[model samples]
Target: MTQAEANPRTMGQQETNLGLSRALPNGSGTEELVPSRYAVQVGEIEVLVISDGVLPLPTKMLGHNVEPKERAAWLDGMFLPPDAFDWSLNVVLVRSGGQTILVDAGLGLDPDLNLPRAGQVVRRLEAAGIDLASVTDVVLTHMHMDHIGGLLVEGVKDRLRPDLRIHVAAAEIRFWEAPDFTHVNMPPGFPDALRAAAKRFAAAYRSYLRPFDEEHEVAPGVTVRRTGGHTPGHSVVRLASGGDRLTFAGDAVFAVGFDHPDWHNGFEHDPEEAARVRIRLLRELADTGEQLVATHLPFPSVGRVAADGDAFRWVPVFWDY
Candidate 1:
């Protein structure tokens, strides 16, 4: 039975109730927290990252230059409205040639966090007319709960069938699953949630992970590129077809204002390393004409990065339907 049907409460619910409709030019909206976007089709290759929901955070989540006045000035500089910071978690799905790929599942709900909005990725996928079980391969960018939490269904594990090989960066899994060093205080700007998420995801990974390297063909037209630093083993994926290439840049770029390459998100485990990788990746992104599909770049987060003086900004260009 489909995962949705497996649920006892909404056995006969209508499609719209499941958030299966496009809300804007390139957005997928749900009645959840805030509306979000889903990306599908990268130059003829079907690509999408279903949204789970928004992580409510304080505004200015990414610390700009010090000084209170300067911070507000920075916010004003970016045209940010009031004190606001949040990220929309995205679950990716890529369809290249004939192969179907799902990258980073969303957070699956449980008894404790009976949040209705959680676990909506599959429903969003269905709204887009994509089936969950048909997924041929699942490649995790990292083992964060926000990223890998959607792998299993509510209660039934056996029915959560994925017919393809699961790929993970060898180092990525080892690092997250390694013995925890929680006593020492972490650095400023470090993301503690990621550490807890690692613990949660590691439990699931014990049964599902398979090793992958820096450069590997995940499927017929998809390639896994190690981007590292954000998470010790984080990797970005490239989807190509019809002479065109699109990179599912994952958390390589966070929410909107922080979209600038120099602006790193507050949730990075290692800020310096994350910044270094972000700059380098942005450089490569700018060099290649390939389009970029980011998980948190304001939904349907597909775009291109270009150098602007010392930093880089995304130039959105998603046209496929």
Candidate 2:
């Protein structure tokens, strides 16, 4: 049976009922203080946005190209901290065409990085009653450590299906082989750590890799298109069904992007190209009025984009509960 069929309650129920009676990792039967998953139905397909916890990083990572004063002003206007803040890590579970597709795994355990609260995808998945083996396919937006680390966690491979298919852009796979860091302005140790994690993940899961050139349809109404910028092969996943649509925009757009699409993020290998890609994406999203989700927006980052003068605006959807 499909994972959805096996766990009908979790799939059928909405966020309002989540975490109320779910089992914890230690087998404790108790409700969590805060909800971490949100359910959205895109026609016949089922989309679950699971919070992978948060990463506390320097605020400058949001716009490394802009002046410090400009960055501070933006943070101040938003009432966020000037130095550092938590960047929400979100992972998605999509059930379509009798297949379960995990789009971007969260940051798995990386003790040396000192990010304690980030790698919770596995625990959260179990809490939601999603069996690792039940996952039929994984469509990676890119091979960034934060996007693929969950699968590299200890014992995670053994629990997954032996014949699982991992779909990713061929460009993404090639880019990581000899990644460029000349243009990026990441924090100390981040470049090496990201490099190590990506190398480890690729080495561990090479056999299951299915590389596509530009676009690939993993399931009905689900398409992943390559948009190189953040990395040489960054991409986004688009889902459409029964007249409803949503785009899981991996790293193409960030919270600051709505206000300053040209601001270069610290992790972008090609900041200028990344900025161009961001502008194009925001314009398309604003024109289409479809739902937008990303890896680093707020928790349950489901929203739509609207054209606001020359910039854009993020319009979050009202809860369906």
Candidate 3:
């Protein structure tokens, strides 16, 4: 039985407290009322999903290819604002085979971007009792600023071990050299910001990069496989041990993907291929009945996929407390 099942009253009270806390002013020094990290045990491997924070983006970004009215209808059906919504930024930490692997670094400080709510991975990790120096390997899904910017934070590299390995797709590293932004439909200033961030990340950690052609095993039960859709070298990390399985789908899947898998997201470099990749991954997960976690899904985005008619469904797992 789950914690809520065992003590529903306590759970309800906790929820009430959280609701009240949300009214408090920001930076009030009160302990965070909302959960920022969640833990899951996949067989013997340990996994933790940390919330880097949320990104407020335009609603058009969700599906640039669809009609505005169609998008608005969907948003209205979900009771969300038609103008904008917050996208959760999730980062995963895995421990297996005596190595601790950080799946993707959250967005670090980018003052010009005006996204101050993000870039909390460092502080959240510390609060979770994880030291930056403990991370042995970092498996990047792509070179997007949100995925690699945390490592570029001031003094972060100095705190990390000198021998840290950052595994990324070779195609990804090369694409960033001269990225093509013609296909993407991002907000103003995003293209320049992404380019500058990727450049800075490459220069800052050139010696630590471990580029891979297709797939690489960072530790036992942890393998990152290149998918090449959202970006030239986008990838997803698969974890399997003792019959338990999970997939950390970087940008291939989004919240609206289940209802409209073919919609093109504004951030996708190759929207067509991205939709294909999303459909393929969703089908696979539905067939296998394994857990799925993604970067942009809601916080603690631990869930399973289910085939629904011509589309798919997201069945979030009960929180384990």
Candidate 4:
């Protein structure tokens, strides 16, 4: 059956051949109000994963055919078949000492963003005992619509720019802030994902988010570094103090981030280069033994890379999970 023909609403799970259910964490391609989870302690850094909601789609937009199949080995072994896609978006709250830092903002009010509960960034922020105004800073890994959408609030009162030292890469700031992306050369009929992403990015740069560049220490022990690929200005975060070190590997990998380096999403400005970064970052993470964080993995979206046979695998860490 076609993706639209099979349980169109989005809750149906696409079970793997081995019966590993691969349903989108949220059926709607939008983020929804999720129940509260605990704030975890990582030595000195405390992180919380708040659900801004999810984006449930009909097919895996980044679908790739895997080789060496097993009985019912769905889509090689990584993706859920029937072409359905369900991706989640989250905002990470990091606390150290008395400092409150938000890793990335979610889709604040863009209906086009299709987040489950349209404007839950505020609610999610509050749920974690954080006040939007109190967030000493907001850090963005890139300017993709989903990653930076939550930086602004609707009301004149709840805005995100109130002294929050927003951090981004130089290339990232220049890319979206430019007026020509609406004309970038992408083929027609490019699904709503890319189109909407482009639109939201243009809007975000013009109205919200503070532009930043390489090596901005937004807070103690937190430094933003370049991890470009998803976008020109894409970046990853390095958090360290005493001995604990963490790298927020934004969108470097998606759902099954470790299965294949080529499992890059359709949005990467350059797919092959993105793959290169994935592999290189894997080495950096492993070599340095740094804690890694993914913006869209599962809840808590933070982990470390482990060697599984030949390829690197995403291993969610205890503190950030």
Candidate 5:
């Protein structure tokens, strides 16, 4: 049955599969309130998963390398909507060594994609009792809107946290600065707007921008590993403390990566490189048994990678309510 058929009141119903209404819900006219923050301890440090919101991506936009039948079968077996992919937006809050660090900024305070479901990072943080001033650092996985969008809050950057420092990949900065860097799949003016936004953000936060390349520690227990493909400087972060280890895969892989590691999304700058990075990262995570914190996985996006023979599977961490 179609989404409209399932929820007769299309206007009031929360069609998570369709665009525009993904953040709001349907039924009773009463909004559903669920906890947007999840906390876990990495040794002595506290790690929180702050939800910006979710985006209902068209299924056709993902897994472009897979055969139509195979992709359909996989979606069917997973009991997912065939028409749209429910993608989650998650950012990490890390408090360690007396410092508060955020993995990615999320959609900031504005929805650059024009999707209402996004741009909830600040709200989620506030709900979690975290103040913007408390965050000392923000590490960008890449320069995408969904990731770096939260670096500034429209006109309230100083009010939010003027002292906050930003950590980004050197290659990512270079890619965005280039004259021809653009997303073929984005809207006509989206790329230009993004570039403009980047310039604006950098101008305001230039003193705080800390660019790095190769593998190195960004914080006391957090290190970023360069994994290009999804973007020129896309990277995955690793948090290690005591004997515990967790890897924030960023956009290196999404939920579909579990079953289709070789499949590439249409938005990737280099589809081949993206697939390669996903496969290599998946294998390492599976072999090492490290917990994964993905940006585009389900909410409370913490999981483990399990090796399914030659393929891989995403096993969401068990949450005890």
Candidate 6:
């Protein structure tokens, strides 16, 4: 069963509903204090961490070739249910040199993907005082639905940010647009929906889309690096300014995968290549003491990779606020 189907109620239903009408000390009540956005700095650049929401992934699917008992035991040890694992949807907004750049568009304005918890990036961005119209550029880490869905606005099907230039890896665009490109072992209609979304994004933003086949700097300190594996042309963003640097490792390492870099996630097209990329990236990040911003590693997802024996660990950056 899908996560949404298993839960029936959308993600965060209880938390949102519980705080909706609760009486507050101010007596006005009706205030829901949920975490939606966070802000961080990389030298002079400003980054706002906006949350699309959360989706529950099946535990078994996260681990490859592992016994059911092993997965259950690991979850139990971590004080979590064995059935579902929480997956966060995070995107970053970079403000530098008067340019407002969004890292990855979230699940857009629609919830048709059955991930009711997601599709809140636009709303959250507004709440955080970010003007979508002022966004100058959008950098897509991959053509995945959740990452690129928000590139287009709902209803009108126009570009979300009217004047923003969309940036993507040329290899990624080619891979997704290929006739033979197909999803393996995914759910029914999932593959078609993903392909359609990619095609739609390419078609809609063709005029402003900039596909980079080689490493290129989008801004003064932001560069896109080819890091394919999860997808044929998956890429990661690197930000360097003054003396600080951070890597936006999109989909490279999840929470569990942080410690178990060898595990093959079911979502990877080439599990071996994905594992290799994760391990090497994690090791480099850890050894060099660079910051990392991952899309799915919990809310306000900024952290550092750490060496843990032969494996690795994730150390979340302290909340600045």
Estimate candidate 2's RMSD in Å. 3.8
* Model 6, residue 259: C-alpha shift (Å): 1.6
Q: Candidate 5 vs. truth: CA RMSD?
A: 9.1
Stretches of model 2 off by over 4 angstroms after superposition: 1-31
lDDT scores for all predictions?
0.62, 0.87, 0.88, 0.59, 0.73, 0.73
lDDT tens per residue, model 5, 1-321: 111221223412112211112223442212437656666666655677778888667776667777788888888998998988668899988766777788998866544456787778876665444667777888889877778777667754654576677888889888877624433454355566667767766677778888998776877888888899888889998999888888988999877788788877756778788889999999999998988988988888788899998789888877733
State model 1's lDDT. 0.62
* Per-residue lDDT over 44-82 for candidate 2, one digit per residue giving the tens place of the 0 to 100 score: 777888889898989999998889999999999999999
- Best of the candidates, TM-score: 2
Residues 55-124 of candidate 3: C-alpha lDDT, one tens digit per residue: 9999999999989999999899889999999999999988888888999999999999989889999888
Which pairs of residues collide in model 3? Answer: none
Better lDDT candidate (3, 6):
3
Candidate 4 wrongly placed segments (more than 4 Å)? 1-38, 63-81, 112-119, 156-161, 178-211, 318-321
Give the residue spans of candidate 5 off by over 4 A: 1-32, 109-112, 179-193
| Candidate 6 error regions (>4 Å) | 1-31, 109-111, 155-163, 179-185
Please provide TM-scores, in order, for all candidate models, with all chains considered together. Answer: 0.76, 0.92, 0.91, 0.73, 0.84, 0.85
Decoy 1 TM-score against native: 0.76
- What root-mean-square deviation over C-alphas does model 3 reach? 5.5
- Candidate 4 lDDT tens digits, 1-321: 111211224213211111112224453332534343324334566555566666554333353323324312544465455554556676667766666788877766665444454446666555333446667667888766566566545552354445656667778767654423332233233334444554655565444455666667767777788777767788887778768777777777776547666664555676667778888888777778777667666665656787766577777655421
lDDT of 6 by residue, 1-321 (tens): 111211213323321321112233453311436666655667766666778888677776666656778777777877888787778899988866777788998877544567777877876665544556767888988988889887665743343566568888898888876733332445456677777888888888788788898687889899988888888778899888778888888888877777678776766777778888998899999988988988888887788888999898889877653
Sliding window of 10 residues with minimal summed lDDT for model 6: 1-10
